[model samples]
Target: MTSTLSRAIVNYPNRFDPGVLSELPEHLQETIQRRNNVLGPGYTLIYKEPVEFVAGHGAHLVDRDGNDYLDAYNNVPCVGHAHPHVVEAVARQMAAVNTNTRYVQESLVDYAERLLATFPEELSKISLACSGSEANDLAVRVARYHTGGEGIIVTRWAYHGITREVASFSPHLGTGSPLGPNVRLIDPPDPRLAAPGSTLAEHMRKQVRDAIDDLERHGYRLAALVTDCAYTSDGIFTDPVGYMHGVVEEVHGAGGVYIADEVQSGFARLGDSMWGFSRHGVLPDIVTMGKPMGNGLPLSGVVFRPEVSDEFGRNVRYFNTFGGSSIPVAAGAAVLDVFEMENVQQRVLENGTALRAGLEEITKDSAYVAEVRGSGLYVGVEIVKDRATLEPDRARTEDVINDLRDRRILINGTGQSANVLKIRPPLAFTSDDVTRFLETFAEVAKDRL
Candidate 1:
């Protein structure tokens, strides 16, 4: 059984505790109270002591008092915060026109063409949406329509989105959002969990096969197996490349399509490739992307093979009020422009390699450091109470993150125990940022771990 401490800390590892309100600055305390009064209990803030950012540029943020913070956890502004190119494109489009897809828009068509070019040849069709939730929700509908099945499989702690349909499979949302009856949870492809002689592929394939059989037992046929290729919410498991091949094979054998949720792992976040699914060497039937597509604008989309979406497209009329709007499309195009102009993929690879090496060096002698794992900019540092036991240290992980926050560095935690330090900054993160983070993290680990 999981401990109460682990369960309580799993969701928001560094969330500010309301019990310590009096310890904060008077102004922040008042602001928190006002925010709570207006936003209600649905919203939560990060860090033991929360911060309010007034501005951001590149890989840094400025607080209310003008203190600079190194941002090592945000993935929304993949190119960078307030990037001039994206800003100019959005402003220019907004000044000219901002309308829905019903209108004839050259920018939307051009952007869609360019975006689709980045994907595999078979994934030729694109459908735009406002958020990852909507994209995943639509992907579910398409999968069910294509396969004539209602069952979906997701990782045990996966977080796809918040929409009613998407959240039904997002087990990381916690107990308040119970999984749907047709949803089956499988353990993430963690190499550590693999049997001694077996490969990660074998282990994952077995789990998927078990899930399909159980779904069948419940009178539900397989529709799709959806997962974030990076496994961000499930401890950032990105090792043993091609481990998903067998899993995808199992899913296909069970008559289910594969949906790669790239909200956190797409657009060169992984350095080596544009999409995380590419790292697995498996072609997904449907690929859903969001978060970084329009820099900070609300933009998301689903790209799939024509055959998979043909029947649905022909039978059902689909339109979103502001999904493929001109302004967001312009911003997305500008992001692609940055990717080309700045050679962001190479930069991510170099910076990510240096960052991981620095982290590994710093945590080498520490007993609390279980492992350093990830690909490219998306990395995780697992924390454990005992190296031998590998028991997750949720409290220590929270302390380390909050300590970094106090030092004007921002990061977060993930996984079921919330003990994995998640360091996924913008693709623009530089060697300087990596150095600063390593030095600060070493200092914090010395004091806290």
Candidate 2:
């Protein structure tokens, strides 16, 4: 059954409950109290029994008691936690010079050029930012300035970012963050939801058209259609490839740009492609990325067609104090270096295939596991009360997550119902880590499901 909890609450199924703080270890209890006092209630911890990690390397994290946990959730450390290359680059650059983009920095330009090379040739102009929210915010601004429209569209449960403009379209932020009057929401491109005798692409195109019509009815001209290519928050529907083509076509037909929010699905996370939008075979007018751009460093950027940004760039003076600073750029360059040196794309493809195969094998007999779907390393295991009805079992999903945590395997949930296990580990995750994760998950499923 679906959760009865307030939609305003962030959809984190494994969120820690403060009422159980007394049951935790004495040290943890003290730590929690201090955190609440200092950090306030704005931040929420995960897991039924919160974990305090002291150190992390590659795909494993070491807790205060020296207990090791396999990391199968965090994607921020795309190349691995504390990777020496990124660490050394950031340190070296920080020691040398950490100036803003105002100063002419060769390394900064070099990093930008390298990053732009990964995208389609048309998306050559880039604007740097400190976070995904900032990148998406800039993207929206550019789209509105270029098209002179106020309307924006996104999936019903999409989580783009936290900036005021971006969050207004990011419905996954929950009911507490009201959507802007100019924003409209549509269902993710789920093939299962296609109507009888219709293809997924046709279904998505119709949805976009309907949203556009509604926006017009409300006196909002279409500015852009933004989406997280991975559909991470809408249950990770990454199948029936090339389905986004029709959706993009519909947006373009309405004189609106398509913004690919690749914060979670970019940088080879989806295995076969360097960016998630490439998998759909449709080029986005603007692309925003972050989370893993500088490994752990706060680096994000928006790359768009030069024509799309020309009006905005000429009229607006954009400057982020730390956006294209030398240190973060150096860290970003190092991340690119690792991708080339380690052949990260190929590794992700192989590892993702193996991981998905193992999970499918283990959960084949499970009544709770309705499906295992994703591209590359970004996977989602849908938990349902009944396989036939496909009713989301959020409570069972929470049990699976907490049980896996007890077994020292880290994972979280996503989707509108918060019933899909989000298995997105660092790109550095290896075959051995995959095996370990599957073995533990199998045991957890057997015991709990």
How well does model 1 score by local distance difference test? Answer: 0.92
RMSD of 1: 2.2
**What is the TM-score of candidate 2?**
0.98
Candidate 2 residue runs with Cα over 4 Å from true position: 1-7
Instruction: Give each model a TM-score.
Output: 0.97, 0.98
Candidate 1, 97-156: lDDT as tens digits: 789999998889999999999998999999999899999999999999999999999999
Whole-model lDDT for model 2 versus the true structure?
0.91
Clashing pairs in 1: none
For model 1 the local lDDT of residue 39 reads 89
In angstroms, the error of model 2 at 48 is 0.4
For model 1, give the 10-residue run with minimal summed lDDT. Answer: 1-10
